[model samples]
Target: SQKIEQNSEALNIQEGKTATLTCNYTNYSPAYLQWYRQDPGRGPVFLLLIRENEKEKRKERLKVTFDTTLKQSLFHITASQPADSATYLCAFNDYKLSFGAGTTVTVRA
Candidate 1:
């Protein structure tokens, strides 16, 4: 079976600092890795996508990865702000996209 694990707890941090979150999995082979941001009850908005062939991909202040050997992916937000507070999800695109529970990030000023 395939499973993904992101931080289930909320991440509280000071504004203007970097936030790092993790995503781990077991018994899964994914073609690509993806990261998304979700606010309150809204659906997840795509942030970045990294292919299995690639080590890393970035957009603006977001970064992501796909490690087949380790069965994990990492996400990072640089110079985070209060406005960046939201739930972060890591997913893998194998056949369909599958997501982790998500980690809520709270940036305080």
Candidate 2:
């Protein structure tokens, strides 16, 4: 009965600032969580993955935090640029696999 939720609105931010997006779910236990970035009219591209046992993970300008107890995952982009603007998705595979609604980020100078 777990359900996932992401920001449905577009996020607009100034260049050089960080953008934070959120994913929250309830009522289920997940083994792993994956994040992906998708551009308009293009397929999603993988960003990072965090296992259920991992609390925090970072890769370059990206960071992810997974809290199994709270059933939440946070995705961050540091020193964001216009090129980083895209829809960010959080997904986890169970039997059928599921994805969040995705949050679109727009960075402007």
Candidate 3:
């Protein structure tokens, strides 16, 4: 069985600072990992995706790192703002897609 875990507690950070989130998995080897952001009542918006062979990937102010050996992934948001505040989710695909519980980020101005 595969399990994914993210920070269940809310993450509070000051605006303009960087925020980092972690995703850990057990008993799984995914081909790729993806991150998404969901607002209060909206569907998740795709952020970044990193493949197993890739060590790091970046898009705008977002960055992601995938380490197969450690079975973990790290998601980063640089120069975060209030607009960036949302529940971030980590998902992976082996033969099927699975999602984490998600971590809520609150960027205070």
Candidate 4:
């Protein structure tokens, strides 16, 4: 069985600082990993996708690094803002896809 875990805490920080969150797992085969952002009751919106062969991925102010050897992924947001406040999720794709419960992030101005 595969399990995905992300910080369940609400990350609060001042605007303009970079926020870093984590995604970890156990018993997962390397295939594909994706990051998404969700606001309130909304569905997750895709942020970045990294493959087993890929080392890292980036988009706009977001960045994702994958370490299959470590069985972990790191997500970073630079120049974060109040508008960036939301829940972040990570998913693992294999025979079936599994997603973390998500971590709430609050950026104060």
Query: Over 4 Å off in model 2, which ranges?
Result: none
Q: Write the per-residue lDDT of candidate 3 for residues 1-109, one digit (tens) a residue.
A: 8899998899999999999999999988888899999999999888888999999999999999998999999999999999998999999866666999999999999
Cα distance off (Å), candidate 4, residue 14: 1.0
Record all residue pairs in model 2 with backbone atoms less than 3 Å apart, i.e. clashing: none
Task: List model 1 lDDT by residue over 4-97, tens digit each.
Answer: 9998778999989899999998887777888989999899998888888888888888877667789888898999989999999888886688
Output the better candidate (3/4) by TM-score. Answer: 3
Between prediction 1 and prediction 4, the one with superior TM-score is 4
The Cα error of candidate 2 at residue 4, in Å, is 0.7
Question: What TM-score do all the candidates reach, one by one?
Answer: 0.93, 0.94, 0.95, 0.94
Q: How close is candidate 3 to the true structure, as a TM-score?
A: 0.95
In model 2, where is the ten-residue run with the lowest total lDDT?
91-100
TM-score of 1: 0.93
When 1 and 3 are scored with TM-score, the better candidate is 3
Model 3 CA deviation exceeding 4 Å by range: none
Top-lDDT candidate index: 3
In candidate 1, stretches whose alpha carbon ends up further than 4 angstroms from where it belongs are: none
Single out the weakest 10-residue window by summed lDDT for candidate 3: 90-99
Runs in model 4 with CA error above 4 Å? none
Question: Residue 8, candidate 4: how far off, in angstroms?
Answer: 2.4
Q: Model 2 over residues 6-105: C-alpha lDDT tens digits?
A: 9888899999999999999887788999999999999989889999989999999999999888789999999999999889999988776689999999
Clashing pairs in 3: none
